[model samples]
Target chain A: MSASDYESASKGASSDVATFDDEEKGLFGRFHHALHATPALVPLIVLMVAIGIFAIVLGERFFSPGTLTLILQQVQIVGILALAQSLIILTAGIDLSVGAMAVFSSVIMGQFTFRYGLPPAVAVAAGLAIGTGIGAISGWLVSKVKLPPFIVTLGMWQIVLAANYLYSQNETIRSQDIRDEAALLQFMGIRFELGGAIITMGVVTMVVMVIVLAYMLRSTAWGRHVYAVGDDPEAAELAGVNRHRTIMSVYMLAGFICGIAGWIMIGRFGSVSPSASTGVVGNIQSITAVVIGGISLFGGRGSIWGAFFGALIVGVFELGLRMAGANAQWTYLLIGALIIGAVAVDQWIRKVTA
Target chain B: MSTEPILKARNLVKRYGKVVALNRCDFDLYPGEVLAVIGDNGAGKSTLIKALSGAIQPDAGEIWLEGKPIQLPSPIEARRHGIETVYQTLAMSPALSIADNMFMGREIRKPGWRGKLLKQLDRKEMERLARDKLNDLGLMTIQNINQAVETLSGGQRQGVAVARAAAFGSKVIILDEPTAALGVKESRKVLDLIQDVRSRGIPIILISHNMPHVFEVADRIHVHRLGSRLCVIDPKSHNMSDAVAYMTGAKEPDQHLETA
Candidate 1:
């Protein structure tokens, strides 16, 4: 056999994606093939299919410009959370603290608006800064203390939950207090007509984040380092990539994304509860979307685009089920099945490629 | 022969608690030569290479790169001194593309007025360089430079790792049992590549247990028995059985053999 055959065999064993004949394609074709062949594409395509089916079922109800904008607005907060979770999962770790951290940050923002009486903009900024600080501390504990991510993040989740309750004094902050800061409240409220339908500012934030994150993963050194650390920390270190530093940055980015999600949540709901979003089940949905979108829990294998499509798929599924008169129980069953099917497909794909 | 050797380790020693790994090991590597280090499982061959590669600091010894005595703090320090190593497992991230693995931490930047703003990878240049380097060793079968290393076979992965070391301008290429995972035919192909590298004036430190392949390519052979050097011999002077006997500590060093 020739050397190319040997190289192709190695590539197949690692990626599970069949190598395309380089002779048949140039640069653009190669990149096209790369995108199509990515494991994450399966879920993304599935999401697009779900969207089409939903629009057909709901007709103008789902496809109307207003409905489309609503879908974007509704998915934006969970989408950000999913993106944050993707970063952690890509490192073969999880941050159970994300939901609690976001909730805690919201409570802190409530304090800024109600107790301290800070400007809404300042309150928002302070709330986000607190989230960032907590994230930095957690990152330090994990990387410096060499704690298992699961243990550290789990402990952090509980700690933040308790902290949120204590700060809010187990009371729901009034919507009036939060809305008084017009600038802060309008951050996610900025709406304009798009093809005769209003689109919220939340959609813009989600779109920009998706683009920036996807570009970073593809082009930047830090992005490469993230992949490297997730792949094999030992090999990455041998290559001069600092594993600790990369992991710290990943957690920080995860925290920052959670802060964005919290910001959207407060803007949309106009209130903060110590236990807000407790029964929403958005975390499970977001994680399931990520898995369906083809981001591997094994780390170093998925992209933010996958996270985007994953979120879209979840949103479409929920909207479709609701239109079909499906109860909350049936929606849960459907989501559970999708997650299982996605995981099963991922395993099958991995085995065949290996 | 024309100049001082590229890398030398004298009195190198290492121990893990009560277990000694490397014991006063002295080694010399010259340009355009393949020094085959052959031994049994517990012969301290790996320990010596690990110390030399700076994966583990020696308990007592001096490592001289280009005739300068320097302490190698880590693998990065060793690489900085122009020493590249290919471990038995290949030590490559299977998820990354071949070009990405080739450049890795040292990627070539695309030519642009703005450095970070337009800091795209010089894809054409990287591919061209990779292809040329592989072609120089007559490896033209690999068609796609974008293919991930996980897609390649054991022998192909071996070639990539070796190609990377050569491409990086390594003064000494330390390969730890490169053919340990290959089939006979594939192993022969890698052996041929080793010969090609030797022809190109790149010294190789080949660590392997296979005696026939070692004798086939190595000009000089060193045997280690129980963490210490038993004898250094020209492959032409002794056959496979003699080398094994020395490595297993079943025979004494013959005085007639040339000593370093």
Candidate 2:
């Protein structure tokens, strides 16, 4: 048969079935379809709604340039960590040790510079290296040993947390000592005024990191491989993707980003303490941002930009709640609701798309 | 027609624990011909193709391409030898665009510093080529090259998979039941595509249970029965009932007939 003949036959066959194009769909169906097509839309809309409500309630306090910038500043650490978590999650994997790794690396930087008397720059590099090394171990376990990412990272989190305490002897690097000895450690905290808004170097770093990663994931072959692996590893492998290598690279990259977050953490707090209490919540917080960002926990969908907006939403909620004199627990309650709502939206979208 | 077979497999044996999937099976393909492999369910049709396509390594076998013995320990290795297999699953990522799925593992990088340093993919080039390949195969129903595979119909997805194989398969293409999940019209489109591919002079191995499709497009049909080849019959010489009888062990091949 000729191609046109087959085409006509196919057309006839398809006409037998009831077809519902996007335009023919009702309001809810269209909305669900749109959500599936553009993952960042829901999160972006939620962010706008949150901003509008908080701006109305808090009035001047929420709308003030300083308060808005303060939200950005407060979100810098978790935002950066969320970027790391986002990469791992994009590959259908999770890294529960991101916060511990950052804290551990920060402790290494402080202790190396003060006790070991290493140069500040060298100490920072060492901290970054240690973060990547630990990440490589996690990747090896995940890709080579075939261990679940969740289990491997969970174990790594505890191990790194313990190591941080033992290696630092539960000591806190005094902010004064860091300022006097390693002034560069405070570089990320440096800020400049721009149009009535205060912008810190840490915020710039976070923005740049997100932009670069978003571009890479959208345009690069390596980024495509990451998505491919997450979408379906067996299909990816048959199509010639190195599944193990892709999985491993994602873990290592997440680790490297977490290491950068560690440097930013030092700048944000100005002190590195080997305390489990403060850093223990890091994993959950980053995960919360990712979940709210509309990045599918199942992977192969969503964007880094969505995760960024997700982090910003949390920042807005926290500041808005404080300014409105609401109880702190209310923030958690609202965030919990958002997480559940976002996942429900995700499921709905999947059903419609599928 | 070339006298030498483009691909030849000898004494292939594969066993899964207690069950033997392929028992010393031998197979061959000539250049510029459509060879169809047909069998009952679980008759080791897929297993034999897997061995040839390098998805599985036979316990004892030798595969020859262009008259030279070659070892294909992996699917990637098979591709290197210009043997591409369009798996039953289609093996294309549904979330990615058609162009991305076409060049999933073998992406074309841009030339110069942007490609090397930044690892930038030549996406426009890939999309253009993907469009050309689809059009060349008369699979141009898809207007957008950037549409995700998930949005396409089952036949279109299969078209993309076949197009990928045809685009890259320089010597041999193996398709495992390309029309199994497709509708009648879609199956016709695929059969036409197989004829188009054969006219291009690249040999094809089509595995199917559809007797009419196999008879319509195949130059020769290999009847697989009980993990071994019962006979290789030319469509002009044997009828469908004869082939079916041989496949079901109700008839035996003439002793004078060639085995491989």
Candidate 3:
């Protein structure tokens, strides 16, 4: 029961005698412990190193304010989607339909305003509500029906994709029409010029979202419950956590975030195409960002900021390659390698701590 | 000790397919005493404890707490009735910090506006109380309350679980094999903690196979066999071999007035 008694007792129990003196560890052991203790550190270092490499290679172009702002603009959509994905991953679940849901929601917004004659503002709200509604369906299937998250979200992706095509009649809302009739539809695309960089409302929105979610996860009771459920649902339930409600809320919140992402997608493109090819890659891109950000695919680990950094890493690679006049295919190759590297590091951390 | 039992179960029956885990079992717990439920493997000791702790519902039974009939359909309901169970698994999240694990489900929020509007947790307060509880249980080896539970040794993990139960257990604490996984010194520490808990006037029901441990701390040993309570013996009057004999069905229990 006492400290001295516990030390002696534990020593007699196992032949591998290890003490709790963390300061006495070797350099490598200390580094391993630090990596396991703070998951964000690895990703943060990677981000910094990437920036340094790009800056050195591209010189004035990469370090310029305009290029930096462009990188922020490019990552906004995936960054938002990654935030949504992070919430699901934290609950030990996945959302394969994040991209489809965002695209479908965007199509709904455009069609509702232009075809259904609803006000642009009302159409936007309805689009967001529909995204949340679809998420509720996934959440119900996951929590109530007890289906695997991957399967449920996979099915939802196809269904939502098909619905987007059928409902819009394969129509593409032109930017000219949107500008002539409902200019507010492209409101988030509006940018203000700072000292040398132009910052869009979409990028600002992404920043605000990351900050709010980070605070929520770090400083709230609900945040702790989310981590608890991810760590062990049975233990969380025994400790008085409502596992069903927690999981359901996480799904619903992710859906709502995806809806916001959809709105940003519209602003980013200045057009709504039912067949937006990017919709197919949205889920993968978001997941990639989350994984590379040092957030555990298994859940109950990593920081929301890490996911943001992960998205930026992708953006940096894309822009850095383009500016350096490298083949576009190289971006994909590097990103693929980075994803593997991140997961390997995650495994190493888990092994050391475990 | 109070003449009337604080908690009692009557004719508890639980069936798992063809296997009858508990066949009309009955049990009782007096106030301010450590009652050890000991038996052979698969002798329904765990099943009986599960039914009592609200982890599993009995097919047909009635459980009385403080002389009142209570329905324990879930662990949350059990806690509401001032009953807490520390399972053999310990039931603490391995990746979560000790303070976070301690306040997993029942986290305290910041006072006034911050709690109401922002829904912020009172981390400082929770950490302070967690340290105090660990110290009260004489488990001060934990240098940081924010360290994850996985970093702790088996004995330390057990200490955290017991501390959590002791901090919140208002009426009765039920421990299922609390020391089954621990070593000699760790087991001794746990026995000391059990005695410490009893001194606080909280009755304990400890289900363990270690007869020496049972005899060391149990005021009365409840011998379980074949899905039912065989008998309850005063540890002072009966020895370990007698308890083991009754548990293994080698010896028949003497006819005595039912304690309940």
**Per-model DockQ:** 0.32, 0.54, 0.53
Q: What is the C-alpha lDDT of each candidate?
A: 0.77, 0.89, 0.89
Error of 3 at A329 (Å): 1.5
User: Which 10 consecutive positions of candidate 2 chain B have the poorest summed lDDT?
Assistant: B251-260
The regions of model 3 sitting more than 4 angstroms off are A1-29, B257-260
How well does model 2 score by local distance difference test?
0.89
lDDT per residue for candidate 1 within A1-354, as digits (tens), equals 232344445443432334656666678555455553587676777877887887887787777777666777778888888888888887777777777767777777777777887777788788788777777778888888988888998788878888888878888876776566545744775677867677777778889888888877777667777887788878877766667888888898888777777777776777777778731355565677788777778887778888788888777777777876778777778778878887776666554242
Estimate the TM-score for candidate 1: 0.88
Candidate 1: stretches off by over 4 Å = A1-36, A112-126, A140-146, A278-282, A351-354, B1-3, B113-115, B254-259
Task: Give the total clashing residue pairs for model 1.
Answer: 14
User: What TM value does model 2 have?
Assistant: 0.94
DockQ of 2: 0.54
Better of 1 and 3 by lDDT: 3
Q: What is the C-alpha lDDT profile of model 1 across B70-171, one tens digit per residue?
A: 788787788888888887767677888787777777777767753357566676777788888877766666767878777777777888888888777568
Ranked by TM-score from best down, the candidates are: 3, 2, 1
lDDT of 2 by residue, A225-326 (tens): 989988988899889888888887888888888888888888889887878343688899999999999998988888898899999999999999988899
Who is ahead in DockQ, 2 or 3?
2
RMSD of each: 5.5, 3.0, 3.2
